[model samples]
Target: MLRIFYHTKYEFVRWWRVAAGLTLAFLAAGLISFAVTGGVNYSIEFTGGTLMQLQFKTPPDVAEVRSALDAAGIQGAEIQQFGANTDYTVRARDEKQVEAQDAGAEGISKQIASALDAKFGAGAVTVVRTEAVGPKVGAELRTGAAMAMLIASFFTLIYLAIRFDWRFGLAAVLSTTHDILITLAFIKIFHIEVSLTVVAAILTLVGYSANDTIIIFDRVRENLKKPHKGETLSHILDRSINETLPRSIMTHATTFSATLALLLLAGEVIRPFAWVMAFGVVMATFSSIYVAGPLLLWIEGRWPRLDDAATARAVRAGEAAAAAPRGADRVSAR
Candidate 1:
């Protein structure tokens, strides 16, 4: 394959400066979002509630379902149309039950199906997905999610340390967390309903951001082994980033375009997921260059010895050859 890695090192250096500025700007925006909006707003699923999905033979009227719930005094109920044209999803908390049993439980779903069947016929609707979240279960889920994220971040730090230098790993972990926090900030700002899907989306973005970091790390390692291994870490990283930058941009551009399409056409339900992924991809690119590279410089560049070992080796070797008398003398000298 054609190796363009050495060709575009300087370009990535310039690009990194621009991307870093944009990243800082986005980080500020995300921070403001966090300040204004409380942490992510959990959905009924995560907050303790009932979810009933009914697939009908025809396109069902959404207003009728909400009206039905309203007539029964089901306050703050959320009804949505799911995948396909026939599915209807209804969710509500079991906070204040007027009935003896939890009305938002299985019995309520059965009643809903029966009511719809009375008008649309018995075989018109099928209950495809249903779940009942007790208050305790929701609390447990929330706790488990928090713990998982903590553990994942810790393990990521350890893995990054073992894979490359501790500086790269530490920076990668920080950048990953930054991506997650910013994504959550956006979610909170827009009041995205946080469900299991949102959790999955966050985890997915972590993996994605990590993948991008690892790729750059790999390129850096490869360049460190080449003849220019004596190059400055910043220059080496810039080179690696430039080599991979094209591919990274292409991949993210394709995904971003697809996400934009989704954001435009997809319903409210898919909007949160699409936005999170799109935001993460853009942020990950910037961090892979500036955040990660600057970290290496800050940590390793603090000392005079470690800072120039690679460059010194290459420069000395070149000067020795250039000053040698002749081809035969250089060969004989070696």
Candidate 2:
């Protein structure tokens, strides 16, 4: 018989500086983008806009539709095929167009209908749907989304605190936030419009990143209970992550594969959503291992008392459990 063994001693915490520097760079770029762009470019859903879904008897050319809208003097109008060649969605903010300042939501709808009717004939075009959001209503929805995310983070912290400890929850939350910041930075860099769909993606990443962090933290807790000889906190964290590395890699790989497929084949309608999700999964995975674990270890190093008490308790519990089996064996022998 032959015995084989592998030694694992990679200290992820040691590279904390590299991770921190990269995060700082990302944030700085996002801030600079904000300064340059005036803010995140919000979609019509965030800024008040008139949205019209149209269906024509004949398949309509997107360029012609855009040209029709442009000729109508509807500046900043965005036109795209919704699901089929004959179906299209158009959105535009209120702007001076041919002295129609009094064209309210209904008037805007009529103007769009008139423009398309001229191109495709009176009875050939159908107004499938129309949605108009006022600036106040859009602002409220945006604010509500921000509040929902904040409340979610608060509850996540409480849940983690009860499950593990305050330090674990704190670290996990911070890592999730980092993932969001990086994702947002990328969104800004690419000039991707921040719509409700994008906000949903950010929230999805928050939950996902937290789950990954919890898995790693749960493993760390178990490892702490069974102290390895000559293992420092950093070593234990490294070991915990190493043990979960296989699972982490497999989980993220499968998600990435799916998301990448969606990005390539899901069509323009969903490309932005898929792209954000794809970017988010990668960031969440990296933050769980590199950012969350290192931050926890750094906290322990700065305030030893915080972890020392928990460590001592775990050691005592482990020793008592070990003695229990011995005591039972002696009794049975007697």
Candidate 3:
């Protein structure tokens, strides 16, 4: 078997300031973008609209299709080529159109179909699929997605607290929360459409980040059990991270490869999900090392455990005893 990053001693915590600064900068930029754009783009599933997939006998001009929709009173509809040049997905989620949908579920879809039929002749185009969501249903789904994320985080905190202690649990939970915020910022900056599938990706990312933190923290706990007379908590953290480096590398590499493949090969419908997962792989690794480790150190400093303080006192006494012998030897030689 190949051994990599084996028995290494790297100071990961020393760069915590740098990592914190970079994270804050990225988040700031995301906030600016969000303000400029007025928020993230939500798909019809969340916004309540008429979605229609159309297939044409021949490829139709996109501009002409938009013109037809506008002529038929379906303003501000989004038209994009889905898979093939001859296939297109139309979304009409404007406030007026959503209100129109309240009158009848398929009303907007019917108008879109008629407009296209008039533009390309009666039999030239076909409606492959149509989905109509009401405002109430969309609102419910949006709320449910939010609740799901909150519940997942709540359970994670409970589990971590039981598994370790409040310090470990709080650090891990905060790190996981950081991952979510960063992922959301990425989505906003890049304008990825918010949908049910994307929500699933964010939830998966939270678990992945939390698990990574748990692994390193568990290692730290194990190391603390053994005697290291002069080692500080920061030193133990660095050692724990170095010990897990090889495993982290392999796991993240494989996951990123899979996500990259999906990003490149998956169709348009899944691209947003793939994008989130791809960014998430790197984000999880980063938070595990930079975010969680430092947070643990800070928490320990703020409220030092009794056992840890006792151990620190013992270390200092040992160092003083060793130095006294050296001082006597030097005085005698002089």
Residue runs of model 1 more than 4 Å from their true location after superposition: 1-6, 14-21, 31-37, 54-67, 81-88, 97-104, 111-128, 225-231, 246-275, 302-334
Q: All candidates' TM-scores?
A: 0.70, 0.77, 0.88
lDDT by residue for model 3 over 118-187, one digit each (tens)?
9999999999999888898899999999999999999999999999878889999999999999999999
TM-score rank, highest first? 3, 2, 1
User: Highest TM-score, which number?
Assistant: 3
Name the 10 consecutive residues with the lowest summed lDDT in model 3.
325-334
lDDT of candidate 2 at residue 195, scale 0 to 100: 79
- How much lDDT does each candidate structure score? 0.66, 0.75, 0.85
Worst 10 residues of 2 by lDDT: 325-334
- Best candidate, lDDT: 3
Residue pairs in candidate 2 whose N, alpha carbon or C atoms collide under 3 angstroms: none
Q: Tens digit of lDDT per residue, candidate 1, span 104-174?
A: 45665565556666656779878887777667667888888888778877787788888876656776887
User: Could you tell which candidate, 1 or 3, scores higher by lDDT?
Assistant: 3
**Which stretches of model 3 miss by more than 4 angstroms?**
57-59, 83-86, 307-334
Clashes of 2: 0
Predicted structure 3, TM vs. truth:
0.88
User: Could you tell me how far off, in angstroms, the CA of residue 145 lies in candidate 2 after the best superposition?
Assistant: 0.9
